[model samples]
Target chain A: MDTQPFYVAALDGLFGSFPTDADSLWVMLIGSLVGASCALVGSFLILRRLSMLGDAISHAVLPGIVIAFLLTGSRNIFPMLIGAGALGLLTAFLTDSLHRYGKLQSDASIGVTFTWLFAVGVILISRFAGQVDLDTDCVLYGEIIFAPLDVLIIGDNEYGPRAVWMLGGVTLANLLFVVFGYKQLKVCAFDPELAASLGIKVSLWHYLLMGAVSMTTVGAFESVGAILVVAMLVVPPNIAYLLTDRLGLMIALAVFFGILSAVLGYWVAYWLDASVAGAMATVSGLLFVLVALFSPTHGVIARVVAQRRLGSSTIEFADSAPS
Target chain B: MNESSDLPPWLEFFTFSNVNVTFVFLGCVLLGMSTGVLGCFAFLRKRSLLGDALAHAALPGVCAAFLLTGTKNPLIILGGAMVSCWMGALSVELIVRYTRCKEDSALGMVLSVFFGVGIVLLTYIQRTGEAAQAGLDKFLFGQAAALVDRDVWTLGILSVLILVVVAIAYKEFKLFSFDPEFAAGIGLPVRLIEIILATLIVVAVGIGLQAVGVVLMAAMLVTPAAGARYWTERLGVMLVAAGSFGALSGGLGAYISYLSPKMPTGPWMVVAATILFVISFTFAPRRGVLPRVLRHFRFRRRTAEENVLRTLYLLGEPLGQWNDSFSTNELLQYRSMPTAQLAHTLNRLIHKALVKEPAQGRYALTDFGVTRAARVTRLHRLWELYLTRKLEIAPDHVHDDAEEIEHILTPELELRLEALLEHPDEDPHASRIPGRFVPGESGG
Candidate 1:
């Protein structure tokens, strides 16, 4: 009864049975949204040399989310957002202060602050497991496969999965922030002293950027988990950084890389029956490796080839000069 | 409730009568010591997060080891972790050296990518429907309770082997950490020493994976060394102290986990290490916050008193009457200090017999105070003249520098400045430079 061609069926199988239904589509949509938003904010992080801060904020937000859950007895979005933003700011503040006043090195300060907060988060989750819905394993890798089950119901009308709506909102907010504060963010990332001299509140912009990272992280938490959020927050931007020089192009390319990773990662997970978030992160990482090795301007191969070419040309010039 | 009810009495827990507890405790101790020692070098080299990347990168290796052997043997899995993490470290080094990416970006890339691969492999393994795969999940956050005696023995031996390597290459590692270029210039095989050090760290991290897990193991490596740094300045002492702190925290974590069935050993151990860090950060004798703050306050108080004395001496300079006692109001005219603060400074000086109230609301310098004021004013003027004459600094810009330097300059520094400035009799402002205080001098 099937009228489809053999190549189409084979392609479908190759894409892990493509022509995906509503559930798979929602999963991919959410993955792309998470990837895009993280990449949008991550471009600034990479430029600012604060890529590791993204990792720190993602891990440190755990206790804030759990405390918000325990207090409200619900996974309401607003409270969780506020809690995560506050904790992200706290992580930045603590790391800065420890480096400045405690006479500790920058990496050591970051390592101490995030690890302590994360440990507390783990302990709180385990101690209050009976009272809250989160568990250690879910906190680590997440359970994005079951995301579609929690649909949003509004006045007897059933919408799609709640993650799509939340992630969409986060993506839109991130886009708006980037669009409006693009110049200020660029100035601050390239040179904070210049931004300050230009009357921009550098610390305020830093916190605002951190707030965006926190919001993106919290929105992606349920679907991808904390560690994978870190991956999305840094990997795409890293890849884009290697491929281009212009900030605008870098942002655009990072989003493209992020979406590519999400789509490919979803299919990889579907085919291999592995964690979807994990596969996405792996894909993003692979893309980074590819760019690092083969990008036209910044790639390792190109640099080596250029060096060799220059060496041979210099030798030829010397050979001719002897005549 | 069932788990807690099954636990032995509190005394039995402390006594370590259980063989499982004994093995776990010993294993954690060794893990702590090796990580602490190796972490010192990592921290000194500014490669703290490299340990983190290595730890995250080890997860895939662990899963690969499990898949290849179809076994959960700690030794076998750890060996796999070591190989993969070493590769990850090498990759990071290459990326930083050969590409435009900085160390931080390279580290973030390797850490997340390798961890993602591990997570993927782990998920696949979890779905394989094998009973032996049950314990493999423990490596994510660590399950010290699940470690057997054989696992303990393996970890202990590997940890000791790492320590021995560190001890054998101590001086070379020290040189490599402090100044790699100098070591290389001296023909010390700097690259080999660095590779050896990196391998030792990988081994230390590899053995610790079973007790602290891949996620939190960096804390074990970094926290103990950071804490130990607060207590000692010598590398030898720091190494010993860091090892002890590591062992104590490890043992304490094991004991606490035994007491509370719900508490996982890894996080508890981290909590313990953090507590020690907090203690060292706050209460250590020299580098701690408390002592530093106290010393700062003491210096501030001293500076205030000396400023008041100098102000009184300057107020009498126009009249050329060093012995005349000046009222607080007259003294206030020369300095912009608050009335309340002036009174407090005068009170402290009176207690020290540096100044006295010859009349109500009037202050006068004592014989000893005259010499002290002369010394302070001499140093201030000497620095001002030095700055203007030698450094070609503007007169207006030299006062602020002299104000701070006057309080901190040692006697030897004053002699050097005096010689350098050829014992100038006047400052850049044309004010007479007071001579160095002589104890037997009159009130001239």
Candidate 2:
């Protein structure tokens, strides 16, 4: 695999040329930052059985991004983040409200809410096609290859990539939120009933988690697009979940896997000269497949081997004892 | 095309003289109709996200087929899409069955993973620089303007096949959707039926990829059926409504994009479907948000009116005066109601001929009003007595419980309470339980 020209060229292009090539370095850094931020909140979402809600939020935040662009009349990250974050929470609220009050099923409401919002976003993009230089294709799959070009500038000083700063701030905020609210989030995720019995406001923690997810999603959306954000949010954390039983360990493992995917995914995309976000998503999925099939305690192979051992030992015991 | 641009967009769209417009419009409508019918089954079975997963999953198949066959043939490409989409569904089932991952996690995983793989393949194709790859990217968001005679024919045949299959296996599909366990218990082949249904969904999703694209196709599948659900409870009616709503959105989407150059047809179709969903969710009769809210307000109003009438009867009970006029202030003292509310209730009661505002602000019960108010007070006091005696509730704690039950108790329950309490003469408060006859019968 290492001898292949595609592989060697990709490795050299991203790593051997690393010090000189700020483009590959920034794309990799930004991807890892986004991946790690998403994985932090995604762990709780998986524990709470709300993985699809993450997918829904990622799509539903589009209109908020579009509307922010429309209002601010520029691709300002702060306004887009605020706008999309608010809409993300609204998506969660509306989905829950429709389920609780409208008597619509939860899955159907999620489907309805996100798709509607995404449609509105797409329509807005087309309506203002001339006014805004927003590309629909970029929004769908993303072009992480161009992430370095959107550099942050501050008063005669070029501070790195804008996506890096945006994603880094979100990652820090997520870290603080998870650290401070760990106990409540754990209780709420594992058992809302018990959390309520203990006098914890389950809904407050639920919304807090939702807000964190929305904020993370908006920050990540620029580089990875919407759907691939789901891949980052769900796949890495899920792989970690299969590997560990403890909550703290799971969160740690998920972040590790997320960053690992970002690093490896960059190479894969460089090799294929394709979508870096898509490559990252594909790599994370492959990692999950590997873990699901080979995890020591819960893997399919372990279970199969255990069952086979039990079967053979029982047969031997029967033959020796007699009959 | 230049000459038609002079006419109103709506008029031109409806004219159907432009062959291209007619093909795209008809193609989208058929796609919508098929997806709508399939969406009902998916929605009922709680597999709405499966459609999303399948739609995203079909991407790799489309690209894979284009690479393998090196042709732009619609049938072959769609065939590849159907196969891979089916595999995606199978993988989700396998993951859930084999692993500890919940259904939603499995769905989210499969949906994004397959889409990622598809993106990789799509890029791989684009980088190869083949001339055929020019329009292949259209499958991502869909390009309805690309529909030709052949594409329309393919969509028509697929739509008809979907309609026929659903119609022929209506009972089986219905039973499988509402209660698959029972369908199996009754000796129906539930697994086979499930496969057939999955196949139907794959076909519906496959046909829609070229029109709504993969990302927005879930809306075409979900919004129409969800909207239709608000309009009816019966399965048959829901299917028809969903199909019509779907077709309407599809046609509207095509027309809007036609009117405005560069407007993508797929998202517009979704926007149109979402509008229908919002309308149905908020305004549909009986099950709609407005109707339910209206019913609640009306109930509250009725309860307020009855409470006022009960107060009027109770005020006159000790005085032994059924026709005596009382000021709004007096009624408020007895009932603890607002002065304005009392006046409003009095007006409504007068309108019903139950009360007469004989003076500027004073009111009195008519003969009919006395009878009506007596029934309300009797139910209230009767409930109090029953709660105290039968339920062993404290005599002092029965008023609040009785207040709520009085407004809700039916006539048959009133008689049952009468028999249960042996027709008590006095409530726990020692107030007279007004008799049903004239005031002289038992109050004093």
Residue A177 in candidate 1, Cα distance off native in Å:
2.7
All models: lDDT? 0.84, 0.85
Error of 2 at B257 (Å): 3.5
Per-residue CA lDDT of model 1 for B1-444, tens digit only, reads: 124445556667666667788899888888888888888898888777778889889989989999999988767887899999998989888888887877778878888888889889989998876778886767756778788888798889988998898899889988888999999999999878978888888887787777777657888888888888899888888888888888888887788777787787778878888899889988899898889999999999889888988887787677766667998878878888888888998999999999988888888998788789878888898889998999999999999999888899999998899888887778999988887765222321
Fnat per model, in the order given?
0.65, 0.73
DockQ (Cα-based) per candidate?
0.59, 0.56
Worst-scoring 10-residue span by lDDT in model 1 chain A: A135-144
Which residue pairs in candidate 2 have backbone atoms (N, alpha carbon, C) closer than 3 angstroms, thus clashing? Answer: none
lDDT of 2 by residue, A179-246 (tens): 99999999999999999999999888988898888878777786667766788889999899888899
The best candidate by DockQ is 1
Clashes of 1: 0
Give the interface-residue alpha carbon RMSD of model 2: 2.1
